[model samples]
Target: MRNHTALTTFILLGLTQDPQLQIFLFIFLFTTYILSITGNLTIITLTIVDLHLKTPMYFFLQNFSFLEISFTTACVPRFLYSISTGDRTISYNACAIQLFFTDLFGVTEFFLLAIMSYDRYVAICKPLHYMTIMNNKVCQNMILCCWTASLVVIVPPLCLGLNLEFCDTNIIDHFLCDANPILKISCSDTWLIEQMVIGSAVLTFITTLLCVALSYIYIIRTITRFPSAQQKKKAFSTCSSHVIVVSITYGSCIFIYVKPSAKEDMTINKSVSVLISSISPMLNPFIYTLRNKQVKQAFNDTVKKLVFLLKK
Candidate 1:
């Protein structure tokens, strides 16, 4: 740990300065954070307890739900505290820790989404061998690989960021300890780190994106050749939720991170960041459940059982 920093604590300039706006932001964040946590938890519980959802698709969803909870919890709750207490100061170590977890969870999600797309491809394109190919051990190994690959992608850049020296400015432009904003405020020459960040981001984006694209291409081709319209509809329906989620996750992220001029507009970027950390997580469970008959049926069964237990 390179502890060579004159500033021990950094002040976060939160979303707004107006007290009225702060109240609104606080309420909004609190509501979304609660919903996000509850929703993701429900997904995890359903996947664990519901026997019908023991398949590879739901298994991947369970892990993705956990990542959603972790990714949002990493930053949203702290910002909520900052708003409620009117204190925006985060210790150096705390900020670093937050950055690490956020990056780890966020990066892992990309790989996981790619893996889910592949799962769909196997189910649709190669149904006969799907069971054997994506068995319990195989699913677990794929998830483990996602985490391991994400660590490999992020560790180098994060290590370089840890050595950054902040000499003068202690006020971060954005709400969280994001890598780009932190690097902007550092006194160190960030040319190398900046390149590394871009390289890593590109690597994660391209690799996972290619996997998703290829998977879907094969899936769509397979679906088109199905003998009946009913079969085609069923195949496409299975993939709809994953496709929507991938679009939301990738679209927002590409706008925020991939563009060269993204940093020029901090306000828009911050709002999009909030959506990524809060809104997306809150919506994902609903998206999966609403479109999914198996999950919905499982939820209804669980509800009936709980009601019966309470009545007894």
Candidate 2:
């Protein structure tokens, strides 16, 4: 076992090692990071200030918006810094901290989405009981559970990763120090730790996915029974947005993490992983607001109010 003091830092290779590509990559990612933050923040502000958006669905959307902010902040800023300063190296402690929070936020988001799905399911399937069931207290509890679950899922791997000896290469191929990427560089026997990480990740992912699937199934069944054409149309519009976000986020995550690590195809795999972490956060708010009539009206109203205030 090596002394803890000996292993102090790790180097992140970032998106590319090519100097020429670095400039272009930096410009592209910086623009993306700014847009993502701006878009998500706008959604959060709109959701909070607009009384019309105080419903259960938008309430969850607010939480999702906040999560997206935290999620991207975990990784994107660092990448930008690396691009600007040409310092892609991350300290071992910083890398571990980044990994922990990335996993924590990512997993929390999965559960949050699951809760939102259930909320929608109730709203559509059991309209009469939606308010009673998804009351403020219940919503708070669900949010608390999402945070708590994220903590539990992240702590064990974080502790284990911290203790391991990284006496070998410190260079991480991916832009971030994700569990799998970091584990690859450890000099210690990481088999058990790897298995534990995989098992924990898969368990949470599958369980949350099952909840989302079941809720949507019930929602679809209920939608089919709606007597009014308008009601059916409304349900489809709302549900389709949720389904799109869910499919993209979960689909990308599962594709990246669940498969066997293809060391030979690191470029494609890393790109896909980065796509999920970076792009998905920005997409959530747009998908929900653009697709829902209520949200669109609320947003337009808010914009008008803002413009009027600014003119004054």
Per-residue lDDT of 1-312 in model 1, one digit per residue for the tens? 244555679899978899999898888888988998998899899999999999999999999999999999998999988988889999989998998999999999999999999999999999999999999999999999999999999999899987888777888888898887887777888888888888888889999999999999999999989999999999999999999999999999887777552235578888899999999999999999999999999999999999999999
lDDT of each: 0.90, 0.82
Q: For model 2, name the residue pairs that clash.
A: 9-92
RMSD per candidate (Å) reads: 1.3, 1.7
Candidate 2: tens digits of C-alpha lDDT, residues 1-312 = 133548676788877878889888887777777878988898888889999888888888889889899989998889889888988888767886788788888899999999999988898888899899999999999999999988888788677766777665778888888877777767778777777777777988899999999998898888889999998998888888888988998888887777554233457778986687678877777787778888889888988998999999
- Model 2 regions more than 4 Å off: 1-5, 260-265
lDDT of candidate 2 at residue 199, scale 0 to 100: 76
Error of 1 at 290 (Å): 0.4
